[model samples]
Target: MNNPNQFIPTPYTNSVDSGNFTWSAPSNIALVKYWGKREPQIPANPSISFTLNKCKTITTLSFERKRHGGFSFDLLFEGQPKESFKPKILKFFERIESYLPFLTDFHFTIDTRNTFPHSSGIASSASGMAALSMTLMSVERLLNPEMTDDFFYQKASFLARLGSGSACRSIKGNLVVWGEHEDIPQSSDLFGVEFPFEAHEVFQNYRDTILIVEEGQKSVSSTVGHDLMNGNPFSEARFAQARTNLTRLKQILIDGDLKSFVALVESEALSLHAVMLTSNPYYILMKPNTLAIIEKIRKFRSDTNVPICFTLDAGANVHVLYPDEYKGVIKTFIDGVLSLFCEGGKYIEDKIGNGSELLTVNS
Candidate 1:
C-alpha cells in the first residue's frame, strides 16, 4: 500500500458494459494546514484535519462503453450541464488515468452537488474530488471483486490526492494525517491515514461553525498561492515549524489539552496566512470580517474563559473550532456576535464526522 505502483490495477477479472456509483465525501478543516505542495499534489508539510459532517459533496458517476477513444465525459453540477468544471475533471483524469486504465474505455456522466457553495473557501475541491474518487473506486471494486477493503480505501485516497492534496484527508474520518512525519511511522505522503492514536474524549465530536465571510471565488486560488511558495523566503522554516506543531499537537490531542490545542491550532492558521503574505507577489486572503471574527473570538475566549478558537483555510471564511461540551454557549455567541461578520448572516454548523460513504452502487 505504500508504493504508488501497487495502486495500478491488474487486468480486470470481471467486465461490465455499464454501471454507476454514488458516493458522499465530507470536507475537512486542517488543524495543521498544508499550504505549499510538490508536483503531483504532494503536500510540502505534514498536516492533520477534522473531517466535517454537514459540508460535503455527493456525486454520481455513470459509465457506458464508448466507441471512440480518449477520456470522454459530461459533467453536471446540481443537474445542470457545467462545462466550466470539465477542464479540472479532464486534468484529474490525465493524472489518474495510469492508475485506473479504464478511463478511455467508457463515456462517463458525472453529476455532482454540494451542500455548500462551490468555490466559497470551504474546501469544495476536497469533498468534491474525494467523492468522485470514492465513486471511481467503487467501479474499480466491481472490476476487481477480490479487492480488500483496506486496499480499496487506500487506493481511493491515493487517487483522491492526485486530484486535490487535501482530498486525501477527506477520504477518512474524525482525524486524519497526511504527509510523512517521523513520529507517525505509518504516515505516508501517498495518502492520508486515520489518526492511529486514541485522542482524548474532549477532542471527540469537536464543533466547527463556519462563518462565511465571502462566498465567491477566492482572490487567489490555492494553486497560485502554493506556486508562490516555490521561492518563498520563509518556506523552509514554515515547513519545519509545521512539523514541530504537529508533534506537539499530537500530544495535546492525547492529553486533552484544550488550552494548548487552541494555541497550536490558531498559530497554524495564522502561520498559513503569514506564509502567503511573505510569498513574492504577496497576497492576503483574509477579508476585514475575517480579522473581525478572529478578534471577537479571542476577546470572547478571554472574557468568558471559553476554549473556543478559530482557524482559516486558504480563504476568508473562518471556521470556529471548539469542544462539543461548549456548543450551547458557543452557538449563542456565534448567533449573537459572529453571525454579523458573516455574509448575509450565513454560517454552517458542523462537527467531526466519520469520513466518506458509498451511497449506492449499481452494475
Candidate 2:
C-alpha cells in the first residue's frame, strides 16, 4: 500500500488502545467574505479573515480500536450527548474517509463546547470542524509519526475544508487567506494558507466586538445560500470583486490604512448581503436590528472618528471591528446606543487570536 502520509504527502504509531486528545480552535471572521463555493467545499473566491480569540470551540476526541473494523463515533456538545449533531459528523466522516483511511480502524468519542452559542451568527461550524480536524491530525501523528508541521497543518486544513470551507481558515492565527488568486502565488480553493505578508501592528491586534442583532438561527442556512449562488446574476462579478478586494485589503493591512480598511470591510459586508438580494428567488438574511446596528456603527464612526468598522456572516449579527485603543469608547457606545438592538443586549468581546491549540492528551 502506498504510504497515505506521503501520498497526500501528509501522520504516527501508538500502542495504547483507548486514549483522549483535545484541541481548542478559534473561529475566524472573514474580512473579505467567502459567499460562494464549488463542489467538495471549495471557495469560489479568494477571502481573508481575522481569527478571533474569545470565540472558540474546544473538542476532545477519545479513541479505541474498533472490534469489528467499521467507522463509528459519538458526539457530545457542552458535555451532553447531542444526537442532532451526529448525522453531520457522520456525513463529514463519509466525505473525508478516503483521505483518512485509519478512521475506519478506530471508534471515536468526541466532546465539544463553544464559548459562543451555536447557530447564533458565530462561525460555530468553522471552529467546531477545525477542532475536530486537529484531533484527527493528532491521532494520525500518533499512528504514523513521520510528518512535519507543514504537512500536518496542510493536511489538517485540507481535511477541515472538507467539513466547512471557512474552517480551513480557522487553522491559523491572525490573518488567513483562502481561495486562489493570480496575485497570491500559493493560494488554493482547496485549502487556506496563512496571509503571507506581515500586517501592521494596528491591524494585527484589532478587536472584534460581536453585536448580537438576532441570537437565533438564520432563516436561510449558509449552505442553502451558497447553493443559490449557482445562477446568481452577480456571481461572476462578486468573485472578481473578491479577488480585487483581497489584493487591496492585503496592502491596506500592511500599510495600516484604517480608513481604506473600514471602507472595504464595510462594503464587502454590504455587498455580501446585496448578492443575496439580487440572487434568483431572492431572500433577505439581515433583520431590522441588523440595519439599526449598521446605522449606529456608521454614525458612531462619523461622530467619533474611532476607526471602527462592521462585518457580517450571512446573518443578522454585526461584528464591530476596531483597534484596541477604542475599547473603552466602543464599549460605552455599545452600552448607550447599540445594546438595545441586540438580542437581550448580548455581545461578545473578542480579538485577533493565536490560532488553534492542543489542550491535552491522555493515554
Candidate 3:
C-alpha cells in the first residue's frame, strides 16, 4: 500500500491557482447490460462489468490557476482536435461543479490519448471518464484533502456519466456493478445469498474481445438510446431481463461454465438491442456486415466447437467472450474476420484491470 503518487502540498483555497495532474482509467465491457437510466447519472437497471485488461485513455490536465470562469476544455479525440465536443465538454465540467461544488471556475488544457482506436468500436468513454475521475481526484486532494471515498466514486461516476453511461462503472475496480440500477442495489441483496453476484472469483477470468463491425460512430447516442428504449413497448420487459440476466449470469460465473456464460451474454446483448428495434421507428445498431461477422463466428464455433460467442452494445461492434485458455482459437477466428473488414480490423488483448494509480505525483 505504498503511496507512490501521494502528495503533501500545502492546501490552497483558491480555485484560480493553476496546476496539472496526469492519470489513466481502463475501459470496461458490460456483462449484464444496462440500457436505460433513471438519472442519466445513474443506471435504471443494474449492470455488472469487467474493467478491461486492454483499452484505456490517459489525460494530462493543466488548469489555468488564476482565471475564474466556467470550465473550459481542450478535447483531443483520437489525437485530433474535435471542437464539436466543446459544448458537451463545458456542460460536463458545469455538471461536476453543480454536484461537487468544489470544482467550479477553472480553465483547463486537457490532453487525452486513447490506447485503442476510438472509431474502431472500442469503448473510449469508460477509460476516458476513468482518467478524468482519477485526475480530478488527484487535483481535489491537492486542493482539498478532506474528501471522502464514498463521495469520490459516486461523484466520479456521476460526472463521467454526463459524458457517457458506461463511464459510471469505471470508478471502481475490476468487477463493478452500479448498485443504483435495480430496486435492489448491487451492493448486496443478491436473492439473500451470502455473497452478492458480483463478488465471485470466477468472474475474474471473464474477458472480452471488441470486434469493430462498423468503424463509424453510433447514430444513436446512449442518452438517445435510453429515450428510444423508454418508447419501446418492450422496455419494461427488457429491464426485467437485465436484472434477471445479472442474477443468472452471476451464478454461471461462479460455476465457471464457459458455455452457459457465453449463451447468456450473447442473448442479453441481443435482447437489449432488440428492444431498440422494437421501438416505433425500429432502428438497428447492426451494420450490414455486422451479421456477417456474427454468422462467421457462429460457423467457426460450429466447425471448431470453440467456446466463444459475441455480444454487442448499442453500437455495431461486438464483444467476444472466451476463457483464457482458448485465446488462440478465438484470436485466430478474429484474424480471419478482420481480414474481411475495412482498413481497421486489428484487435487488442485485454483482461480485467485495476483502476487508476498515480504514475507520478510531483512534489
Name the best candidate (by lDDT).
1
Better of 1 and 3 by lDDT: 1
lDDT of 1 by residue, 140-236 (tens): 8888999999989989999999998999999989899999998876999999999999999999879999999999888888899999999899999
Which candidate number would show the highest TM-score if scored against the true structure?
A: 1
Output the lDDT of residue 85, model 1: 90
- Candidate 1 vs candidate 2: the TM-score winner is 1
Report, for every candidate in turn, its global Cα lDDT versus the true structure.
0.93, 0.88, 0.67
RMSD of 1: 1.0
TM-score of each: 0.98, 0.96, 0.84
Worst 10 residues of 1 by lDDT: 115-124
- Candidate 3 lDDT, tens digit per residue, 1-363? 112112222345634366778777777788778776655355667787777765878888776553464455677665688787677667666655644444555566677888887787677767787677777766776566566765455555555665676776776667676643343343521101112444446456756777666776788777777777667778888878888887787667667777787788889878877888888777788876677777887888889888788878778877777767777777777787644653365556677776655565542
| Candidate 3 or 1, higher TM-score | 1
Q: List the residue pairs that clash in candidate 3.
A: 16-65, 17-65, 18-65, 53-351, 179-186
The sequence of per-residue lDDT tens digits that candidate 2 reaches over residues 86-199 is 989999999888778778888899999998888567989999999999999888777777768987887888889889989999998888888888776678777778888889
Q: Candidate 3, residue 104: CA error in Å? A: 3.3
Model 2 misplaced regions, further than 4 Å: 1-16
Cα error of candidate 3 at position 198, Å = 7.2
Against the hidden true structure, what lDDT does model 3 obtain?
Answer: 0.67
